[model samples]
Target: MNSSYDSLVDLFLKSLRAEKNASQNTVSAYANDLNQFFIFLQEHYRKKADGIELEVLSHYDIRSFLAYLHRAGYNKSSVARKLAALRKFYRFLNKEKLIANNPLFFINSPKKDKKLPRYLEEKQIEQLLALPDCSTPLGLRDRAMLETFYASGIRVSELVGLDLPQINLDLGYMVVYGKGAKERVVPLGSFAIEALQNYLRRGRPVLLATQNNDALFLNYKGVRISVRGVRLTVEKYVRRLADSLKISPHSLRHTFATHLMERGADLRVVQELLGHVSMATTQVYTHVTTSKMKEVYDKTHPRA
Candidate 1:
């Protein structure tokens, strides 16, 4: 009677934090979503969040919550994410023997809107890459980092997390640690290799400043470059040359994937390169390619 629901929720969240290695941000977001769901339950059952019983909650009850979110004008993607959080928490409850039946086991998740990622056109990418003045150490590092981004289509985290042993410039590939610390070998094109070589020889050493940082990319202080540092570096060049294009470092990542797919790269190959756990995630770039092809066809055809 003393808020058993709250106790179970705490146990589940603790599992996410300790066992699953979820970040505080992730745990907090999941916690907030569950809090919203419980508030809706409270409105229905007239009980505190911890007083709601497992036997009383049903799939229809969860569906009603989804409907409530929709009525409140929550976007489809947000609704879907909330449902995902529910699924995880309920699964945790079931695993802990707190629930006799998983109420949400068969519940269908809310459909999410299809969103195509934004990317730079090839010409625009070339312009952005050229904006970095390679004469200076910081500029050379930025240039190499950007070159590696486009060449591999790597997540900015993976790009910045790179270390000396992870890269094999001579072999034209590098091992990228991705989500959940999963490892994948991504090919680095010659342009990326050359840029990396230059930075290693000229830029990184100049910035090293007698510090023993093993991080492949370094800041002005000769320390590991933070994610913000990479984003700002890209933004500076992008704001200068491609002023009209409101893009982030991920735009270069998207451009890398879209360009490769447009040039007839295998979808699975692109998936591996991008470190996508699902081919469906990689398939979004195909949509971009198809759209581009249609645009080209519409513009160039003379038979109309």
Candidate 2:
């Protein structure tokens, strides 16, 4: 009987490469998920990972792995993705006749509640953007950062990773490399263009004194700004605007998407601008607008 789990893992990886044609990122994700699962199985079943029989894995083992993930502070999304990988692996094993049955076939995934993302109101967004004083070089840079965030709706990672050559200030657009290193060009608003022009003229030169070259936004230390630094800068300005509205850099992204949808923008256009792989992901903003409309209707209707 083939009892070596390591051999099965090797075969599975080979199959993924040859038959599944999985990308490098997909292969890496599967490897990590399986390694974590193997560790959990070893601890729970009191057997070494390489020595454990494939058939020894039961539905209880799967449940235990999920429980361990939850206890270790993983969020629902992470847990769900891990479980999905396990399910796919087990299904493959069963199909190959290596396992008698798939344990995860009967197991249900954890119910993940879809929480509507928090976003800023239009007036609050304006207030936050205006909060940055543009007289000083740092202030000009901050203003440009704030405007670019709202105008492009790019992720903080994408924003921090921006390069000078990727931006076309005269054309009012910038190219962003998003998740999976996929590149897309997004248009900037007039406000962002103006702020960026001011920063390039006044702020970037001072920042460039110590460091030379192609990064778009820089920190006080003359290096490219980090995601954490951008988040802190955003939080600082948000705090200055209003005490009640809790805001983060991502709130600006949500506001940009939501406001565009509310203003009759094409969902496909918004999806492309947000660099969403699926239009389904961008459609959530419409639900947010619909919920707001219901709130206003309930408040004004005179029915008993």
Candidate 3:
């Protein structure tokens, strides 16, 4: 609302990109969350007996904002994310000496409901992989892309950011830059390697035409594919394969990790493959695998 608010957010976002190496999506989410919070503050203080300045903002004001979000029908996860944005913003202000005290010090994010990540069975994955036609150039690219997701369990952003130099088809692995721009080597499966090889030999060159782009995956225009493009490709086949299935490109990633864990892969190894900074994030797949086991036991166990 105010120029000062805008400037502070801009500075904070710059630090996130420059210092923390945050992704564009992360920066945009934080910006949107902060803007929403500021808008609520403007309306809130407008009705108050005394307008509260940013420097003098307290935990009570933060709680009031959370209450407003709840009343406005924001889900717990969404409210928690907004709260995180506020906390980070206030911390930045305090560090910059723009504010004397951080009002969000006592604030806590809302507890989220523990929903297990969705993953596909091997049969479903096989069915999904078969849906992409490899006869055409775009089909070849989509097949390679889908194979890569399941093979490496990489995030969509990382996959789309791939360059010609990052992949070593001969070695059966590729280097990917994950969150915070961290670099790691991910191994590719035989099926993925073959698909990628076919795309490179037949599909990619046709799409490349006269263009000189070094991007691993290119659109018909010969430019690197966008994250949205990859998602749409994944969605098209997923919808064709099964209308009831709620799968995204990320679901392929989930399938990758879940399948690995189901087969007794170590938690740390799965974490390393997924490029997770924390093991806790990778541990969720363990639950998914366990749930799957329980379901199988219920169906096949004679004692039950």
**TM-score for each predicted model, relative to the true structure:** 0.76, 0.70, 0.73
lDDT by residue for model 3 (165-256), tens: 99999999999999999999999999999999999999998899555688999987878999999988888998898889999988888999
Position 116, candidate 1: lDDT: 89
Candidate 1 C-alpha lDDT tens digits along 1-304: 2367667778889999999999999999998998888788778666554534665677888788888998999998899899999889888877777776677877887667788898888898888888888999998998899999999989889888999999998899999999999999999899999999999999999999665678999999998899999999888998898578778989888889899988999999888888888988888888899988999898999962
lDDT of 2 by residue, 1-304 (tens): 1247767777787889999899989988987898888877767766564533557666777888888999999998899899998888877787788877667866888878778989988887888889888898889999999999999999999999998899999999999999999999999999999999999999988887465568889999777999999989998887788777778888889999999987888889999999999877888888898988788789999981
Which residue window of length 10 is worst by lDDT in model 1?
47-56
Cα TM-score of candidate 3: 0.73
lDDT of 3: 0.88
Off by over 4 Å in 1: 1-54, 84-102, 165-171, 175-185
Ranking by lDDT: 3, 1, 2
Descending-TM-score candidate ranking: 1, 3, 2
lDDT of 3 at 66: 93
Give the Cα lDDT of each candidate: 0.86, 0.86, 0.88
Flag regions of model 2 displaced more than 4 Å: 1-101, 300-304
